[model samples]
Target chain A: MSHPAKHRPLIALVALFGLCLSVPAFAQFDAEAAENTFKDNDCHKCHHATKAKKGPALKKIAAKYKEKKLDEKEAIKHMTAGQKVKLDDGKEEDHKIIDTKDVKVQTNVARWMLSH
Target chain B: MDQRALILGFSMLAFGSAMAADPASIDWGKIPATKLTLFYPGQSSYEWLRSEGHKGASSETARGDSCVSCHDDAKEEQRQGAKILRGNHPLEPTTIAGKKNGHVDLSVQAAFDAKNAYLRYQWKTQNPFPGNEHQYLRFDGKEWKVYGFPKLDKVVQEGKQPGIYEDRMSIIIDDGKVPGFAKQGCWLTCHDGQRDMPKQFTKEEVAANALLTAIKKNDVRKYLPDTRTNPSDWKTGKSVEDIAKLKEAGAFVELIQWRAHRSHAVGMADDGYVLEWRLADAGKDMFSGNADSKTHQPKFMWDEKKVGYKSITADQLRKGDHFLIREQNAVPFDPNAGWKEGDMIPDYVTSREDAKGSAADNNAIANWKDGMWTVVVVRPLGLANSDDKALKAGGVYNVGFAVHDDNITTRGHFVSYVKTLGLGAKADIQAVKLP
Candidate 1:
């Protein structure tokens, strides 16, 4: 009778832990997976969290998009279809090309980059 | 009896089989496969001169290497360097041969940035073969991408055959070939209605086209960082003294390329004698204007009212007044490889042998009919050799030489030289024999 009373709290805690493990851990997009995707696809070649390259810096990508109120869907669609962006000399360049399928991942990377 | 017959039969079978296989299949003469090379300036990756056994590089070699060792085959078709070459055709050796390299000046690129892409075609000679096309390259944000090679049905508008013609070709980048994106994967490839209008473009233009094609074609799998077949695996020349300096950078990007099919349409005309000149020992600001001139052109500085060298540059003459001094030998710098035949290379494509370095007493090669050679004359503004004791700031020199066939297309050289010398784009420098 005394042993049963002592083990009751421990058994209750184990049941709660099992329930937690059964559900999927979700926090929007997976950052590491998206980053690897960007690198393998050459996105990282021109972009870096802290540095800039032939393209604009990606760290500020999230803030720019957020300010523009572009969500995952809108961002991916824009990237896959190139737009005439303002070049350094203020010329219009109709040359960027990443697709809509890459949006969520790109957005997550952008957000993470902005935060980090 | 059966065993002895079987042995004999096997030997006979092997011998007969080898004989039957077309003798043409094997190139007993060892001719290089004709392939054109176009390179991009920044991404030149060809490192080593040779991989495994093959030689002759259309790309840059490893750090601190030379362009001559592997391209040792001066056998006409594969000779390297440039000169004012003249050919008689076929056995007459009509195809001009010395090959040199150039760079894409960014100033030129800035001009093209306004357009989509540029295309080049080099026909071996004027005898119209079918199917010649120019390829285009498009640029992505960080890298250049290729738009599909629009099969330009043979450019049939007949222009003068021997005359050089160059034009820019704009391409549509978003033709929708790449898988993921709308305007993503594109391409450019040199195809004429005919095949193999090979050019000796600087390794960068060749590499640039190759790299963009690889990325767009998704052939990136074969792009090992160390493969000679790829430009990224290329090596840099320690001293490609013959090649143009801008080519060492990225000037290839901004220029249009052309192949001068030998002229059957236009013969040497009388408007003005066309001559090709390569800037040898050309430096700006090294010499003070002799008679108080302000311009930098070598010729203009020396002659007050006289334009440029009436015939050649000031530094071209032999050391002494009478062209007898063996001190200044005639080496063709326009196509620097002209001076290059020794134990290293014996014969050019024309089968003319370079018995020895031309005798010091020799200036211009005189064996026009006996062998194949081309001579270029220079008209410099003012050049006194830096160390030549007999010369002063205003001392003018005249140097000219005939080296082994340089293979430079007179029209091609004129098109480029005219632009480089600030003579404007539409220059008409027809090749005429000048004394």
Candidate 2:
């Protein structure tokens, strides 16, 4: 019998192209677009890279969810829509919402935040 | 003790004494500097943004997160910021109202010896013109009225708002007594119900409530969460009893202001604190009007016997400019004199007697040249006054800065976000050590 594995590269290429075409209609995570959303909202004004400012540090946020492996859908919703957050001082404030309407952008931001 | 050893000890003591006496004399060039590139945070005024065509444009940047992020060039950033402000206050955009649309990049240098901390700030002005001409109300041969209109107000109708005010720089300091300053910066103080803000309290409310009726001020000073409790619960919903408790707890932000003309005349800036625009200077708020309000007569004429009050010509009164009261001394406001339509009163003359000890606390020196104002303000560190936030060595503080220029007041000024300043220590926004 002809070795099926010999044609594996060709089969993989075709399958990848088909997958790309199928996913084109839905929002795919883009790192650059997520970064753009973060920048546009000036989220760094309070949330810093390493240390906490008015809000928690991005690294801490990433660490908090690293173990939980929370659903990405809920994370994106909270980031875009904002939620009440208790601060270090025991005081609470509505978390600042990212400034965008597109779901793709929101998804990208969520991915970027988790990656931090 | 050995004679040589005794002499050496005396010399060391003398050297320490000199450093303690003049901490302000530290050479700024030797000190490391922190350069801050501040951008105008856009229409900070809530009422202005809610208007038509102006909505949703508050954070709409041409590019980048903040103003300077995309508009890297200072000159270009200034112009673009001005364009935004003009779009908001359409009637008189640009320097006609003496408004600088954007943030001025500031270079701050800090030095601390054994006793005090000194900060020297240098920033370029939007325009070369020094805003020394403060409130100028001219006698229209009948009553003293505001000389002209500020750019913000509707034209033709003369508003009580003065067209001329001194250029000013202010610093709001928090030593952790004031809550939310670390998180929210100046916004904790700048909320509704304050003067010149939406839903401003009526005069009747102010008169009845001691908390509302603060110090005699043109507008309300900034408030913190501890004092202003009604709006939020992180110590929110503050009552009269709550305010008294806060005061007893010493929960208030310290405000230091340096005026170009008013306080500068006395060679000191005024120090005050806030509750609800309840501004009280650390010392006497000197420099009262010479003209009696009801009679409008010159209560105290310029003593021609001591120094003659000179008359300023119409030519000296440049068509679009003339608030130069600091330079001109005032004579009696003679209502019977031949007064023209554009004749202005001498800028309210400051009385030296009223400004003796009260004005000498916060010493300052200002020089305006080459289109920038370099002001060096010197205050002794660790003032143990009950009202003062005793700036300690190696301590960090949450600070907010504001600048008033271009003949406007209230919400019409440019502001900066929360910045941290450390004495003898370094933070993210560090005030580094002197050589």
Candidate 3:
């Protein structure tokens, strides 16, 4: 069987695109671990996929943060420092902090929220 | 050939064929079907691991992600199969070694007609061996002793907990009656301070509390917001006066549970739907512990003299329906009878008449075949009961689903996100329109 030598450049380009999309923002960033932290921190109870429950939708948060050019550090500070978020009922509650000592995990979790 | 003899032969053949037909068989092929993948609800608010202990956590501030949002394919992720042994909160690592994990892949289908809605689920259990053993307080040749406990018990935590529990399937429905269910789903009802939590209530506490006793239940399952003055409060300081007010206000959620070994024994399941408010059972379970303390014999036998315990060996238990000791009529525990250490009697069976108005109206049929259980649950639409959230036509409602298999129970079961089930229109999680 002869190898397709003419398609080598095309294959290389495709592989590069896949790697760019798959690489983590940080060296220590773990998407799966961060996702687990998101659930454990009770982030899912209020935010939904596309709809607003108690707070804003996650997609909305992702869009707003992305548009403003927010980095993982800023996202982590917003989540851990307990910013006041307005509810649908116009009531405000202190944001629940992501309870973890590892700052790397926290940053990874923030990146996940921003990725959404 | 004699003409008269030939005519008589034809007449006999027609009569024999007529007797063989049965009308009770369900025509599942005619029903509209859709297949879905159902995974376990990873961590509910009740089981969330927060820094400030289990206190101060409310459904209002819960995370927005659904189970599927994070852990999409559970079977591959949780392959160890023993995560349930920890009961969602393990102070220590699980002691049971080499046990299966939580990644169950389920196939679900839904169909409805004018009167009833049918939901079918199929899943291959982690343990190839079926677990039908249940809690049995047996006679130890002297005093009647509690022989076995579910895996959650402290005594049973070290690979000692008998893997004896009924596989259960439940549906949480919200039809505009229960508030915040569509947004929060089952977590609205299953929060901190309930049974099997970090701050669990003792049996004495359940017996003493007016609200718990009024509902005739010993465990907490689901509670609505209005049922408590502070929906986030998990304390037990409320007086009977407070509970009475909540009851009068009619703050409760409809919880229907179907146990393979419990309700399937006496051939009644639709009666298993229980209404829970403020973590109390609004109705009575179909089968109760029917062993007479004095005699140790079952108060209610399967009319065994009428329907003998169908003899079944271990090989016959591989597939289809098989006889379990829990499904048979109880016999008196005889201390002098030289019973073995692991010997047990059939769980007490209750008749249809015994359940009465306390039963919820839902029907179920289960068959175990090829390391899998195919369960069919049927429920009527537009029930007039005050507690039940009537499943209506042309209305979209929030629904949560949970499955308890492999002899585990409580928060250890798998859960789904709050999905929209539209009767006739478009929905986020569709339960297709029936013709």
**Interface Cα RMSD, each model:** 17.2, 8.5, 7.1
Task: Estimate, for each residue in B325-388, the C-alpha lDDT of model 3 and write its tens digit.
Answer: 2323333333444444434344444433345453636556565667887777666677765555
Residue B204 lDDT, candidate 1, scale 0-100 = 51
- Cα-based lDDT at residue B361, candidate 1: 8
TM-score of chain A for candidate 2?
Answer: 0.70
- Residue-level lDDT tens digits of model 1 in A61-108: 656766886555555555566766665556555444642364456666
Compared with the true structure, what per-residue lDDT tens digits does model 2 show for residues A1-116? 66489898998899999988885222356777775556545565466667776567778887787678664576777776678877676866666676568776777777777777
Q: How does candidate 3 score on lDDT?
A: 0.55
Which residue runs does candidate 3 get wrong by more than 4 Å? A1-116, B1-43, B46-99, B159-161, B203-210, B213-221, B234-250, B270-284, B293-297, B300-342, B358-360, B428-435
- Clash-forming residue pairs, model 2: B98-B406, B133-B323, B220-B277, B221-B277, B229-B236, B229-B237, B229-B238, B230-B237, B230-B238, B232-B236
lDDT of 2 by residue, B338-387 (tens): 55554555445553235433233455556566878776665567776666
How much is the lDDT of residue B207 in candidate 2? 61
TM, every model:
0.23, 0.64, 0.65
Best-fitting candidate, scored by DockQ: 3
Please state the error at residue B72 of candidate 2 in Å. 17
Q: Candidate 2 or 3, higher lDDT? A: 2
> What are the runs in model 2 whose C-alpha is more than 4 Å off?
A1-38, A41-116, B1-26, B39-100, B114-116, B148-150, B154-162, B204-210, B213-221, B232-244, B297-341, B351-353, B356-360, B428-435
Minimum summed lDDT over a 10-residue window in model 3 chain A is located at: A40-49
The DockQ value obtained for model 2 is 0.05
Please name the candidate that would achieve the greatest TM-score relative to the true structure.
3
Give the clash count for model 1.
Answer: 76
Error of 2 at B157 (Å): 10
